[model samples]
Target: MTGKKRKRIKIGDVYAIPLPNGKYAFGRIFKDAGIGIYKYIGVSIDDIPRVEEYQFIVGVYEYVLKSGVWTFVKYRPFKSDDEAFPPPSCIVDNISGEFSIYHKGEIRSATKLECEGLEVAAVWADNHIIDRIMGVDKWHKDDEK
Candidate 1:
């Protein structure tokens, strides 16, 4: 696969990710999953800030960040089957194994490096949650049936 240098994304960076329905979700980086074979791209839920409420629904994405003043970076999906036990497709020395985020970026990147796991650890400790909108369902669950 073609690889590029991975960019370290910060909060406020805009991004776009594909939805299962063929649509796409866009938002800013609420959290970052330090460098690794893969990375997490956390986006804030429309009206929510906490990560607990809606995180399980959208889950973390495996992706690559694009270059330039673009929030909507193109990315590939980490096959749904890989969701259960996500191992880094390709990890750099300065990163973690269980990276988490809302979107995917950095599938194959050269800019990969190690990151401070403290920030991410704190977010997880808070049980970060994103609130759901009145009309939009964060995700589909079998219980909905």
Candidate 2:
């Protein structure tokens, strides 16, 4: 019997994977298993409505800065023609030299930690939220502290 050829996938590579519902999702390769088996965390392609080559979205938020403390009130998207602004995907707060991830308007205070860890956690949280909204399984779990 002839063997089927497997596609090569590498870590950090963004790919369009076929979903179970006969639709495709855009996933970023998270792990590379030998023999073409890979573990990926993907968001539905429909989630990213606007695709731009080089675009940065500036968020408009009402914040109060007093006594060196900044409190964010709400987030609003800026009007733009080239890109469609979605709701605030994630909020990275750096207060007192600690980073925290804010999801769905709630501060996950326990996640506050060093910058490196916070960065990873923030991305993970954002991806998790997007996947949830799109009805996809979460690819990563929060590391136990």
Candidate 3:
């Protein structure tokens, strides 16, 4: 509500994530409610850098975006159909310590073994996710919740 309201977020829109250390990070909306966070750690680059400059570190459902925590940088469409992205359908809740698979508009419970070898989904927390990006905090398999 503070800054100018943006229209409904569309996929492929890149955004600037301002970090506290005076550095900046970048993320792109890849799908419904998900953004592929790039690997920038503490880089001081301000504007959205070229894709070759950073790699896709992780894909997450970032709630911060809904809260308007990021500024719209630019729209970068996927190069090809294969470029469309999102993590696995399996989501592991950090607060409830539950795992579920969202498929075909249905949500089903999943066991730890069922989620093995899959890119388990995660919701991006604000600073906590920033810590993860900065290599301070980490998400280990044992840390699954």
lDDT of 3: 0.64
All candidates: TM-score: 0.24, 0.23, 0.63
- Estimate, for each residue in 13-130, the C-alpha lDDT of model 1 and write its tens digit: 3344333343334433333342211123324222212221222222233243443222334233323433423223333343554433322343343232433321222221111121
CA lDDT, every prediction? 0.31, 0.29, 0.64
* Candidate 1 backbone overlaps, count: 22
Which 10-residue window of candidate 3 scores lowest in summed lDDT?
Answer: 52-61
Tens digit per residue, CA lDDT, model 2, 42-109: 34433322332211112211121111121111122324422232222334444554445443344554
What's the ranking of the predictions by lDDT, best on top? Answer: 3, 1, 2
lDDT of 3 by residue, 1-35 (tens): 22333576777777777777777777777764556
What is the alpha-carbon lDDT of model 2 when measured against the actual structure?
Answer: 0.29
Of the candidates shown, which would achieve the greatest lDDT relative to the real structure? 3
Candidate 1 Cα outliers beyond 4 Å, as residue runs: 1-6, 31-145
**Which segments of candidate 2 are over 4 A away from where they belong?**
1-8, 29-133, 136-145
